[model samples]
Target: MTAALRATGVALEAASLIALRQVALRSRAEPVLAALPGGFATRRKGHGHEVADVREYVSGDDIRHLDKGTTARTGALHVRQFHEERDRVTLLVADFRSSMLWGISRAFRSVAAAEALALIGWQGVSEGGRVGLLALTPDGQVAVSPRGRVRGVLDVIGGLVRAHEQALQSVMAGTVADRSLDMAMSGLERLAPLGSEVIIASGFDDMGQGMEQRLAELARRRVPRLIRITDAAAGKLPKGRYPIRLSDGRRLRVSLSGHAQTQHETETICGRAALLIDAGSGVEQTARLLAANLPADRAP
Candidate 1:
């Protein structure tokens, strides 16, 4: 049992590292960290790599320092231009209420879901993108989105883990998973035309496909992605008909002998459901399947 637990930890850590590496590469901040911004590459007047012809300086021009050659040619002092792009925002939603607290593995569904959110948020912050938590449950509060400093990334992950522990200690699942199911989708709907990237991280064990259908509508407007985190237990029941004993000592036999069929059904549901959110696919064995479906540009 101890060995099995250790193996699980190793797998989880490996999964997080894989996601972190991917985010680092996609951000492309390695070599440039040492050099000041706009210093490594020579600035071109136009989009080219070298000096193109220059024209009269405009109000929007940088005009910090103009190219002498361009000034000598047309006699207009214009600042050099460089390549640039606007940063994109990635909204992440985490559900931590009743439904996610139950699972079939060493970790419950909530733990895996929180793990996915942590990695994805780390990626968004590392890439200098805006990250926000749209909704949360049990606690009935949102972080209001603090700036994604490196320390802030670590803090958010730590806080999420701590929050889970507190929930367990305090027994805060008094509310049902369906407490705000429709309302949650309503919040998602308001974020239409996400323009940037939208990521919804949840066990997705809520009530029905109403929120999912709304998510499908939202997907049409922007770069949409879904990171689904599920463990083997949540995917299917364990094999054999063992007595399911209750806390009150009541026992019932469950007929899960057809393990293969059950597993197939669970996988099918997860896959087809993901299609509704424009997600390519997902992972059922562990929380690491996020590497494949993350934003390509944000990959290592």
Candidate 2:
């Protein structure tokens, strides 16, 4: 049933793309983009450069990469052209640790991850790319390679939703699995072979000193680009005098009423630090940050 729901959602998503905006023309500063590396520029099917559509010219905009085929029809070189692809694999990683359940905004961390992942996958499909899936399973994790097929991406997401649902059940039933970050690292290893852009979604609460060391090692050795998700509650605690319950039946609270001023000051600093070292996109909230940071057109 969960699988079915995911499939239906995926179908609806693809259907929704019928309304996606397209830039049938190119601008002076624009070039053509290809799905695969080294894909060449070609002319638009019917028209040659005579008309063009202009859009925001990002700094990394490349002149040579423009599809003269498109411009030849529009007759201009305006850059931002959006296209859809049939197959491109997007890999998504979600963190299911208990910490993800916070947020005074009534929006759980899991919801945030889902929203961002959905937007990212939607953007991927808009570009005619396929989305892949990699996620935590409480007992372990999952990995799906990049595929151009829409069904493939849906399957991955369905598996993820089921895995998360099952994990939650296990916790309620008190059958904890021997899980760790190793699952994520191992999954990433599997995903690495695909050469697809990987997006790992996590609050990374388990990053103890040991885990942090391991992550640093992974960063140094694997050279992975990560996007970290964060929540307001995860940032800091104001001077407070209320108790908070723990999943393990224990309780704790902030009693900074005495040091409200001091706690508030400390919290401010700590909040920034946490944001600086977030799990995935780091400080960037939007996914385009990655594309934006790509080396600007060096092909002068």
Candidate 3:
């Protein structure tokens, strides 16, 4: 792994993820926005119930949201800035199947998925939006409802750790897979409210037959962003026999023929809007990819 990868601990840790909050905060100052459709109201702040701030009234300011006391006291027009009463909920669905338990560099694909979700969760919290989590493990699922501020972010972080650990245990036990991408999508549709924004982080190794249709149906009510996590060896590896360890702790040799398909199945499912991130990428790169892919309105 290059120095840029800057791999963290092999195991999942919340303290490490909490530390990324500062990085998430800094990323806002110098955002590298991606080209996406405009008018996403996921992070739209306007005249509503809760007051966000009071500022000098500018041209085009809504007079109804004006602060009469502040204007009278200062002898100048001032207005109250209110956050939309309806919470801008961002539901993060991270896949933790056995396939995500492997990685070529940096953290494991599962761990990297957690890191990505943490970064995005922090960003959502910073924007005064609510954040939730849905972790699809090999055995089952872990879901967290949308919550705002620090508590919400913490809930998501905790959920990620729990789900990852469950998946890890299942992998070690060599258990049969019980959860799949299609099931996760179904959980998302059931849990996510209308108008909520959904982001699913997965390796897409198990993009089931029904996934494309499920995602399409989800798009009608909620804005969904698919984040495809990949490893460094996603491309053709050198043709040779290599020793590998299985999830059950068994060792075996596998042969590579140097023929790997460049799959666009994820893009095809999401209508050419899937975000790609390498598992080998470090926190910095993950942050950049997220900022580039997420809706502009979601940024702080």
What lDDT score belongs to each candidate, Candidate 1 first?
0.48, 0.45, 0.76
Q: Which residue runs does candidate 2 get wrong by more than 4 Å?
A: 1-89, 182-184, 208-223, 233-239, 256-300
Give the TM-score (vs. native) of candidate 2.
0.53
Question: Residue 54 error for model 1, in Å?
Answer: 22
Candidate 2 per-residue lDDT over residues 1-300, each given as its tens digit: 245323322212332222221211111123433111211121223322332454544578766446665567777654635332233345666666555544444355554554455545545544455666766755566566665444554665565565556555555565554345544456465674343445556666654435555544544433333445565443344655778765565688756443312111011111221211222222123333322321122111
Tell me each candidate's TM-score.
0.55, 0.53, 0.79
Clashing pairs in 1: 22-300
Off by over 4 Å in 1: 1-86, 151-155, 169-180, 185-193, 220-223, 233-238, 242-253, 261-288, 296-300
User: Top model by lDDT, which number?
Assistant: 3
Worst 10 residues of 3 by lDDT: 1-10
Residue-by-residue lDDT tens digits, candidate 1, 1-300: 135423442123434433553544444433221111111111123343344354567787666557777788776676666433225556566666555555554555555566566666666565455555554555453443544546555545555644555444333333332454445545554442246566666656553556656555665665555545455453355566756643223579776754543322122232333311111123221223343344324421
Residue 58 CA displacement from its true place in model 3, Å: 7.6
Residues 136-172 of candidate 3: C-alpha lDDT, one tens digit per residue: 8888889999998999999999998888778777765
The TM-score between candidate 3 and the true structure equals: 0.79
